[model samples]
Target: MTAYILLEIRRTLRDTTFLVFGTGMPVLMYLLFTNLGGGGDHDEWKAYSMVGMAAYGALASAMAIGTGIASDKSLGWLQQLRITPLAPGRAVTGRAISGSVTVLPTILAVLLAGALGNGVRMAAWQWIALVLLLWAGALPFTLLGIGNGYRLTPQATGVVNVACLMGLAIVGGLWFPITEFPQWLRSIGEFTPAYGFAELGRSVVAEHAPAAGAPAVLAGWLLLFGGYAVFSYRRSARTA
Candidate 1:
């Protein structure tokens, strides 16, 4: 299992696709927004922007990790694993672990950009809490990717992932403050995984109690995605 996880991580790192979407694009977006003076002169606003960008980076990376399962299945990696002693579910588990591992770099990049580029400041506890929450909040997307792997073709994976990710991020106010959106739009954004995830990240730096509803929302999404992944895996296993 250890060896398999290592192999998966190394393979993902080698491809560089993950790095582009996960780390580079998010950092670029952060720089672009801040360079335009998105954070403005307020420290609190800087913290808000910083947390949002970090959340965006983390979310994008997580989506990349989850959706890439389609590519792996298409490339016969699953079949290759069948000859080994890894459990049926372990393949997805390995990818989930890899996603968590890969997300660290993106988080760091966003945090540094927030601090150095945008002049945001956070205490040590705030930093730790933000990172921890972002990482934990990624579980839904990790499950989402595993579930998607079973149903989506490699050809459609890229389109689906990018569209879904961007849509959720935008609607959830990661791109802009949710407060600025129309009331109807904000209502819808509240239901998206991004809303809960990003809001949770925001709570860390803002030194507020996390949202009362975010955990429940996250739990619901995780359960739904995980159940789908299990069903899809069983069907695929039978077909194989």
Candidate 2:
């Protein structure tokens, strides 16, 4: 299991596109936005952009980790692993572990970009808490990506990933606050994982407060996706 996880990490790090999308794009967006706003001490704008960039990082991480798994499965890598001594659960565990490992660098890159370029500031403890909250808030999407990758064909998985990211970014206040959105849009945002994550990140970094109902919402979605992953894995095993 450790060997497999190490191999996965190595392959992921070697992927140039993954590095670019996972870290480069968020930093680029942060720089661009900061430049546009004159890079001032506008606390509200700083907070909003910081949270949004963190949410964007989460989305990017989900797509990379999830799609990599799906692509591997489609390429028969996972099938080969299944034929090995590793149990199905252990194999899944390795993937999750590797995903978490890959996600950390992206998270740090986003935070640093915001701090250095956008003038967002937090104490060391706050920074640690913010990282924890961001990861916690992202759990649902990560799990959803796993479930989707496990269930869908590689081509369809790509489409689903694109749709999910775009949909969430648009409706979840990453582009703008839910308050600025139409009533129906705000209603939709209220129920989304992205919204919960965005609010949680903002609360932690900007408000210096605990995430508001983020744990509950994330827990619900986590359960939902955890169930989906199990069911899909079982179905796939049976079919195979």
Candidate 3:
């Protein structure tokens, strides 16, 4: 398992697109938002935007990992692995483990950049909790990405990636606060995985409050997406 995970991590690191999107984009967005002065001068708003961007970065990483897995399947990687001692569960676990390991450094770099560049602050415990929450938050979306990758063609995977990113950005309060959005939008955002993640992030960095309902929402998403991944894996295995 450890060897498989290390190989996966190395593969991810060698991917140019993954490094660019997972690391570069978040840092670019953070700098843009902070420099543009659009988030307002209020410390709270700055903190909110900083944490939101970090959470968004995490989501992007999860999506990329998931889609990459799908691409791998399309390219016969999973098929080759299935003939080995590595079972489906262990394969997926390695993917998830390696994805998180690769993406996490970028997430932390974003947070640190926010702190040093934008003056966002959090206690040590809050920072730890935020990291935990971000990882937890990525799991469901990663599973969803895996399911989508397994089920969709390469071109379709690109379309779904765009749609998923836009949906999460708009509904998860990355573009704007849920409080300012329309009632219906807010209602939808409240139930979304991104919203739960954003709220948890904000709670830690901005509000200094506990993440109340985020764990449950994230867990529900994990279960839902995990089921889809399992189903897709079974169907694909049979077809293969």
Candidate 4:
């Protein structure tokens, strides 16, 4: 399991597309958005934007595991794994762990851009908390990715992942403040995992506990996605 987890992390790092888009894009977006707001006058907005982009970046990278898994299945790598000693469920879980691990660089890249580029400052503890919470919050998306990988063809998974990432970003207010949305839209966005995930980090920046609903929303999604991933993997196992 440890070996498999490390392999997945290394593979994710090696993917040029992931490097450019998953990790690099967030930093680029942060810089662009902050510059548009004009200089250092909006430190608060910069911090808020930093959290939003970091969350989006982490979410995108975590869900890329689905495409990787679908590609592996297409190439018969999963079949080769059957002869190994690793349990099927354990292997999938390791994939999720690895996906979460890969989210760190994306989070760091955006945070570094915020700190150096725009002077978005926080205490040392807040910096640590922000990274840890954002990384942990990506777990549900990683599980969702696992389910998609097992249930869809590589082509379909790729398309669905792109849509999912964009939809979540738009609906969950990762691209803009939820307060800017109409009341009805804000109501819907508040329930999304992406919204809750970003809020967890923002709460750190604000130096307050996250709202009670944030953890509850995330926990519910985590359980739902975990079940979906397990069922999809088992169904695929039987079919294979």
Q: Give the best candidate by lDDT.
A: 4
* Residue ranges of candidate 4 with Cα displaced over 4 Å: 37-40, 83-85, 180-185, 238-240
Per-prediction TM-score to the true structure, in the order listed? 0.86, 0.85, 0.89, 0.90
Over 1-240, each residue of candidate 4 has an lDDT whose tens digit, in order, gives 999989988987788776677788878877987797575677788898888889888998888879888888777777677568888778778889988867899999999998998888889999999999999999999899879998889989988988988888788887778999999999999999888988898899889999999999999999898888878876665544
Candidate 1 residue spans exceeding 4 A from truth: 37-39, 82-85, 179-188, 237-240
Q: How many steric clashes between backbone atoms does each model show?
A: 1, 0, 0, 0
Candidate 4 residue pairs that clash: none
Residue 199 shift from truth in candidate 4, angstroms: 1.3
Of the candidates numbered 1 and 2, which has the greater lDDT value? Answer: 1
What local distance difference test score does each model get?
0.76, 0.73, 0.76, 0.86
Better candidate number, 2 or 4, judged by TM-score = 4
lDDT per residue as tens, model 2, 1-240: 899789878887888787776777777777788677686767677766776776787676866577777777778776677677887666665666667665677777878877876677777877887777777667667777777787777778778877888897777777767899889878878877787778777776655564556667767877887677656554454346
- The lowest-lDDT stretch of 10 consecutive residues in candidate 2 is 230-239
TM-score between candidate 2 and the true structure: 0.85
Q: What does the lDDT read for residue 108 in candidate 2?
A: 78
